[model samples]
Target: MSRVDSNNERLMILSDVTKVYPMGDTQVEALRGVNLQIKSREFIAVLGPSGSGKSTIMHILGCLDTPTSGTYHLDGAAIQGLNPNELAEIRNRKIGFVFQSFHLLPRATACENVELPMVFAGINATDRKACAERVLDQVGLKERTRHLPNELSGGERQRVAIARALVNRPSILLADEPTGNLDSRSGAEILALFEELHTEGRTVILVTHDEMIASRAQRVIRILDGRIGQGSSDNHGRKE
Candidate 1:
């Protein structure tokens, strides 16, 4: 079991975080004083309307984009001023991301697509291949490892993406609209996979506009106008 303490074992922390974008002479506030804590093995949903800054929060958490102000700590390391290379290293080592569009290289097979991140991190051929194959099998994509993205169904492609995300064995899996492009059946399959991962002690943070999808998470954070709203829950699907 993972111990919870400020001194150790916290998977993610965001304190008074804000991201401001320069729009001509003015600034657009993407995230306003957002404060959140995500512990190891927690399944969280950051839910909000389209412009509510959930995207900004996701970007910050994934290390894909930096906040304009405030602090973010991942596994006890302060990450506010880390440079691109450093951030990339952290992203590769600690964060796994699944986006709605299923960002797989068109020319690559499922196994090859899943191996991309590990490749960038300098994992050798044998180990990388093994890791990719293992994760693909775990995600129920073993039979599709040789298939190209176009050859697979939408759900299959998404599963491939999930396998790719897990190939690096990241402690935190950050998914953005993971079910957005899938049908209800596919979406539910994805949610079930998330549940399985959560049960297996992975920290899963999912961002989505669908309350139904958000319902799967144990915690739901509703954001409005760039700040957290007045709602909170471990039962997001319950009647409002």
Candidate 2:
């Protein structure tokens, strides 16, 4: 288990985190000394324009990439210097990621896609299958469990992806532009689902450029030019 403190108030922390990308003789800083803290069940939005480092933050939060410098503690464990395999293990065990593109298996059904995470965790066939079915139903896809990516509508496919993300019961649901490719109605539906998850005490961190979507969260952290800007939201929120 991660080294949770007695108070157990924080789920993740980043202290002066920085990420630099190699660009020939020069280096581009993607994240610049970012400091953030997330509690166990807070819903947050990391909002910024393209190239503003929100995506980099998302990658780091999801354990898809580590920062070039500084510290990150997720679920009370220090994650700054973990090896690739260790990072992969942490990702599989603690983070559930939903991306802009639904990266479902082209040949698999919805339940099969949802079961992929458990397969990596060495879950037995019977339990994994049953869990997949239950989560798919939770995401409002009970009737579409057998549908292939090509057979489902965009919204349904996104819901399947959400189901896949939830199958492992991760500590955090990290989404990157989850409704970016959907129509207004579909996007609203997906956002509603995110809100539902938040209401149920799940930790949700959404990275998006859409202000409307960001507004739905309880707190919003604005990133600008690879640095955190002023007036970031507190626990109390910014609006009525």
Candidate 3:
């Protein structure tokens, strides 16, 4: 896997990106010539209602899918032309994803769950455990490392998921409706954690439909009808 250059300021750029799916004889346009750019260490929120292409955009940005047309550049690398193996390599090395579903293995302990990514990366057992514990502690779940998913609260489980995502030290953190399954307080706590990560200089992209949730981000980019709507300025009031 190629390492993303730390000196590169533009972390992601999508120009005239579009995605289409064929259903029977009809074609569905999920994204319509979307254009977006995200710089390093920016906390951005992509907000849209259900079936509004937000999820599709997230998939493409996360390298889970490719654009049908146009270009996507990530950390100075052209992404749309990469093969499946190359895409997977980039996703594993440079992107961390936290979804609405905790997606934790029911049988695995918090430490084990967080170790899965490193496992796939071919890290040895000792290092994987150590890294997992360190990240779990970073997420404030140090004492619960031995606990299973069912034993942890919703927020704690989400924290474990976040810890898993961070275990690899990816260049970008992509979260899709991360707080959707938690209570209001839990959700707030998760958002706080995201903010803390952002302050630590991680590029965090949050995808959600909730205004209140989206408001927590430094910048909010609204999406509607498969296209980007007006976007708010960054926290410093500077437009990117």
Ranking by lDDT: 3, 2, 1
Best by lDDT: 3
What TM-score does model 1 achieve against the real structure? Answer: 0.93
Candidate 2 wrongly placed segments (more than 4 Å): 1-8, 235-240
Compute the lDDT of residue 88 as modeled in candidate 3. 89
lDDT of 3 at 172: 90
What's the distance in Å from true for residue 215, model 2? 0.6
Residue 226, model 1: Cα distance from true site in angstroms: 0.7
How well is each residue in 1-240 modelled by candidate 2, as lDDT tens digits? 134344548888999999999999999999999999888888899999999999999999889999899999998899988999999998898888888888899899999999999999999999999999999999899999988999998899999999988888887999999999899999999999998988887899999999889888988899998899986765443543
Cα TM-score per model: 0.93, 0.93, 0.92
- Candidate achieving higher TM-score, 2 or 3: 2
> lDDT tens string, model 3, 68-185?
9999999889998899999988888889999898999999999999999898899999999999999999999989999999999999999999999999999799999999999999
Q: Which of candidates 1 and 2 reaches a greater lDDT?
A: 2
Using lDDT as the yardstick, the better of models 2 and 3 is: 3
Over 4 Å off, model 1: 1-8, 236-240
**lDDT by residue for model 1 over 136-223, one digit each (tens)?**
9999988889999999988999999999888888888999999899998998999899889878879999999988888778889898
